[model samples]
Target: MKHSEFDEEFDVIVIGVGAAGAAAALSAHERGASVLVVEKCPPKCAGGNTRVSGSGWFINSSPERAAVFLRALNGSRTVAEDVVQTWASETAKNSDWLADLGATARPTGAYHTEAEFSEVDGADCYAGMNTINGEMGQFLLYEFLVGALAERGIEIRFETRAQELTVVDGTVRGVRVEGPTGEATLGARGGVVLATGGFAANPEMVQDYLPLDEYVLWGSPHSTGDGHRMAQRVGADMWHMGNMMTITGIDVGDTTGLFLALWAGHDYMFIAPDGRRFTDETKGNRHGHVQRNGAEELFPLRPFHIVFDEKLRAAGPLSPTSAVLPVGWKLLMENFVWSTDNSVEVANGQIRRADTLRELAAAIGVDPDTLERSVHDYNAACDVGRDDHFGRDPETLAPVSEGPFYSLRVVPLLGWSDGGPRRDGHSRVLDTRGEVIEGLYAAGEASATYSWTKDGGFHIADALAFGRVSGAHAASRVAS
Candidate 1:
């Protein structure tokens, strides 16, 4: 459908009102360019994944340490040397830049401190990283950005979705948008910045790219890969479309409920549908537990269940509310329940319970004999204080022999996709033949910055760093 041209034009048009889009608009406006930020979701749900995230900042005190850590994290699939160097250097100074914008940095727990490198099993990637705790978590950080944008007179049209990029001659001109009113093409003299996030919320994209059976998206529902499809339509190159930062947890039966199963911790054992322990369960909550059996086997642990006795349930909250939620918020406020006791969940059929391992297996639709054998073997390992199959810590090992066993089906909870249109260090989108697409830029998860998983803060850092770069370069073109 052809759309009429917008009456008013701006120097820069930023797509998606997430962290990257917010930063891009702010940066462009700060550089004396009239900016317009368009968001698909309404103002209430505007911040995308950045608002629900833990809002940690992975800052290095020194650029040298930052480079070494990034090099190790991005093993074979390395980013360009100059890009890596720029990211490393800029991330060190990003904390101050963010602080100047009214966001404060602090240590998250104890691990996110400025420390020397120490090797853990799978957690060695975060060496010299710290976190940013706003005055009131991610909410305040997002509020600050929104407030800043409003103060600068940058118009953020909520409920306005960028449909396509409008190009003229060889230069990208602006974006065609569908808003609450109607469809129109908003012209941009500088360029259009795509900060539209990833495709984790799209099931078809997840099935085609990521190796998972049925994944639950824990991030923003607004991220439906709009920017990715739009960029591809313009001959932009893509990379690392298969990589994702995923975590394992039980589905609380609600489609939007992504509760991290505390039972997946050291206290319980994860058994596949065939009733066998696949991977070590002691590693932290962020580690992906989906195992691949062979070249043909994609997801060997689909419909995997966590087995635990009554003791673990009585210990404390089985599944804490998301860190994004404020303290003292009612557990029952949402559609799903979050509590230590599994009785409510069991009664609701979100969690299954049985008097015996055989009965439990039957209830959850797995082979009873195999499930019994798997439990017996795991209990035997607990008795001997040694995990032969998977080297799980002895301290977290607890026998599941007690009656009234409980099991909940768990699946991979996707945080975000680490893939999209490839961009240069200057934040200009590159095409298939490695040529820059003039007047087109991308940042945040919309661009393939961190192809491999690092820590939490790297995403936000990439958005801030490249958002500034993209905004500055785009505005510079307008000035010239």
Candidate 2:
């Protein structure tokens, strides 16, 4: 499609209005550059996955400790050492930086301590984490950024979608955008920053990159790989195309609903369709792998059952205190109860109830005899205070030999995809041969800076760090 030129020109055009894009716009404006931020979603839903997230930021006491965590997360992957080092050092000072900007942040607890990292084999290290507390933390951060942009006279066009990056003689010129008016091209004198997030919402892109068939999105529905495709058209290189950060234990029926079953702290036993325990149920409710057959065929795991007894059910709800549901969603689901009490869900047919293990297996369409034997073996191990099957902690082990049993059918949930255009320390988009693409920059989930999932706060922290770097670099080019 042909594009008409927009009357106004900008020094930097930042795509998407999430955390990274907001940071980039603010950073560019702070450097005295004319900036325009284009967001596909409306103003109300402008924050994307960043707003809906837990609003945590990972910051280490020192760069040395952070480097250890970074190296551990990028095992066997060839991430640039300078990039990782920059992330480490900048992240160390992020909390102070945010505070200087009037953002409140307090240290909560590290997901992984230095001692814990040493004990777990091949475990991703998580250290020095903080959460933006209070109910308004998420909203406040975005609001502050928006206010900053307005104060600097940087324009943000809402409901405007960036379609393509316009390149003139191998140098990026600007972006083609579709908005309420029409298709128009906005020229950027400095550069364009892509921060459009990932492809979790795009089924075609997810199918091409991810092997799992059945999954639910735990992030913003607007993450449709718009930036990835736009950059690829201009010969940008991509990386970690198969990497995804996933969370499991989502009820198949509740996939579209706001509620999520973060069963990390629960004592439910996960049984495969063949009626045998497959994994440690107490292990963190993230990372599910699709098994490939000998013929190199890939398929999702069969629907599994989360079996719990009356005693464990009486302890508390299957949902954890850390479970993230939108505040508005809580009001909508107020009438609907999701607890391990089994009364409310059983009445709604969301949970199956049985008097015995064999009957429970039959109810879930699994082998009754095999399920019975598996339960017997599991109960025996529980009695001995040991989990030989999956090395589960004995504290979470509970016998499933009660009169009333409950089961919930669950599947994997895709939080977000973390594969996109590759970038360097300066957040400049690079080609396949590792050469920088002129006048093009990428940050946040749009660039594959994070090859593996680290912790809850790492993504947001990385986004802010590189977003500033890219914004500063773009502004410098314009000044020169």
Candidate 3:
């Protein structure tokens, strides 16, 4: 492609302005490559999932041990040994990289430090790094990256969405973008790095790729699988398409169509649509992983409902004023605050209420007799202070026999779907034949390293590590 064919040109073009994209742009610029970043959202909503995430990166003491841990976590769907080693080594430099970009690292709070899989090999190497001053789920870390990019005078075209790659003889050279000014072609002299997050917010893509029968997106609303589609159109091989990181929550359909917390009161119990208790209600799910048949698997998607009574309602709020991660369209972008005492939602008809358990069952469309029997059995167990069915903690065993029952429907809430074009250790997007597609790269959730199980801070750590890899490698490539 000739220079005249594009509206503008740069040595590198980075799509999506999250941790990965910002890292890529900064890395490329540091290497003397002129970089251009294009974000689909306007300046206010530009950070993607990184802004809403806990904003912590993994810090490992030993690369070799980290490799062992990663391999164990991957299980049968293993990443190549070389790629795993590269990831392990590269992640060790995360703190140094952040420091170089003028970021101060501090320990992530206890909330994020809880071990996800302590039994895995090399778990001893695990540590978490976050910005010195910032609240969890706030945009502080993302702000640091964006500030670094700005300090370098790197140009970011807010509201510019990359539609497709401009390919010449199987070599990607530019991006076709749609922006406020309408359609235009922007050339990349080095390479194009795709940092577009995941498909959690795209219902059609979620239905097509994930095995879940029902779910609600809890990631960035703009994460609609743009990078996946673009890469697939260019013949990039995909991986880990079925992998998902999920939490359980209720869909507050009014504000952002994102999720709200299920009942936080101790008196609540989760029941399937049939009104029977399922897993232990108070058990801490490891990103929605629960033990099934002595093996870990995703908490199955089902019509879940929290059955409680007036005792629970009077205890406090069913949902918090803010989301746990506080990312999605509602919390991060729209500033939609949840009710404090569950009164607002109940009055608004989002929560169903009734004068009796049978009436509550009817309101939520469950069999009244089945609900009554389940409650009776549950109350009997509660009275004895022993739950034989799911082994719920005796302290949390509260009877639901109080009058004026309530039921709120909930489902699996996806943090992000980890799947996209397959990329090698160098962050080069590969074709189906495992060969590099020249001038094409992917980083961040677009080509995440996690396949089966993800540890705390893995997503941001991977994004930062591979974002640099993509930028450095792309900068080395000769212009087509």
Candidate 4:
């Protein structure tokens, strides 16, 4: 069981090879450390989540435009100002690094449209991506990054499943990986980095860790939280246990339930536990259909409906083949994206189209009078380019003119959200007692207390950023 003698110890050992792990490994290797990147799946499998998301500098970021975004993200939360500064400073280098590794970063403006940008520095600029399937933006992203690392003389052992960590004297020394040939002891001379992703892939863990239905994660099966479990087993501090995410995608049907085509957006609604409409789809500071049931905030709608007009449907939201998911494609296609068609109404849980507004509300099972009044208020505003109630999309309104209007029930989909285990600006994983867990580092979805989930954009970007920082930091510890 002890392979400290025959074990192939390296200066640094990185687990997982996605965006975070890849960045970490590259940074460590560039620093003159001999590295071993262990991946359970081959190149294709490791592509995981980053392989499919939209193209853009998420969290509404840019070197010139970050301060406001960061402050807005921090809000009342206990975020390290210095860490925000570091993430802003290093993003460009990371961008360039990614470009060098064959990943092309295109620019998508921070605002959805140029109309929303403020004329100020230290502000967030919108930049989007154009990643692809064979484009190395696809499954090949892992392949390209890994190849770049190997060319640098870093040892990459593929098909290696790292099952356990070997700790000595309270610090992690290395890991025990089981490969196809046989089990091998891979020791880390300095430290071990767990860039292994989230528990979205594991239904069991989904039940144990999250409060929502286990169907929230629309990511990879390989991201079954092996790293989370292993880290927790060794007493690694879990900062944002409540911060795990549950994404709501279009529930296609019985067989193909939750079809996640990023290019084909999910125009679904966020309904309350009781069937009722809440927030206007086009309104809100953050932009994910699934998030939380705010305990303190007093809002009329708990779960928001993401309805679209007949005009939206005709736009022909992009398909699964495109690089970007058109934001509302899925809901549009499923008639779940608000419509006035009988066919779509029939398909959406037997929603009925009313010859009159009262009849329509009754068919959908919502408050008939309240629903009619809401419709009247919404239509009056739609005629002009303004939403009086919630200040929704001023320009993108189309009256529910065509009849037998349909509405699908919506509900808040929650991911987990934990509130403790603070870290410094460096993103070091801390212990239960609020001290750094020396030689051990955590990133990606694994460390969430510092995440700027005030909106959906920062959650991912931070995950990617910290993933890199933790990896490089772990590698640095290996040399001394």
**Which candidate number maximizes lDDT?**
3
Comparing 1 and 4 on TM-score, the stronger one: 1
Q: Residues 368-436, candidate 2: write the lDDT tens digits.
A: 888888888888888999988777788887787876887877765566677889888888999998999
What TM-score would candidate 1 get against the native?
A: 0.90
Candidate number that wins on lDDT, 1 or 2: 1
Measured against the true structure, the TM-scores of the candidates, in listed sequence, are: 0.90, 0.88, 0.93, 0.73
Query: What ranking of all candidate models by TM-score puts the best one first?
Result: 3, 1, 2, 4
For model 2, what is the error of residue 287's alpha carbon versus the real structure, in angstroms, after optimal superposition? 7.1
lDDT of 3 at 328: 56
| Candidate 1 wrongly placed segments (more than 4 Å) | 1-6, 114-138, 263-265, 285-301, 322-336
**Which residue pairs in model 2 clash with each other?**
none
Candidate 4 local lDDT, 437-480, one digit each (tens): 66666655545434434433344455556766766777677555
Off by over 4 Å in 2: 1-6, 109-127, 133-140, 252-267, 285-302, 321-342
Worst 10 residues of 3 by lDDT: 254-263
lDDT of 1 by residue, 1-480 (tens): 112455558899999877788888988887899899999988877777776665555665667666777766566778877777777777777678777777666656544453332332223434344345633244555677788788778898999989999888877888899999998888888999999988878878878888877766666776789999999999999987887766655565544446455743455788987888777665554223222232111122255788887766566556665443431112222424465465677788877888888888989888998888888989999999998888777887788876788888888667778888888878889899989999999998887477564654677777777888788888988899
Candidate 4 has an lDDT of: 0.53
Comparing 3 and 4 on lDDT, the stronger one:
3
| 1 or 3, greater by lDDT | 3
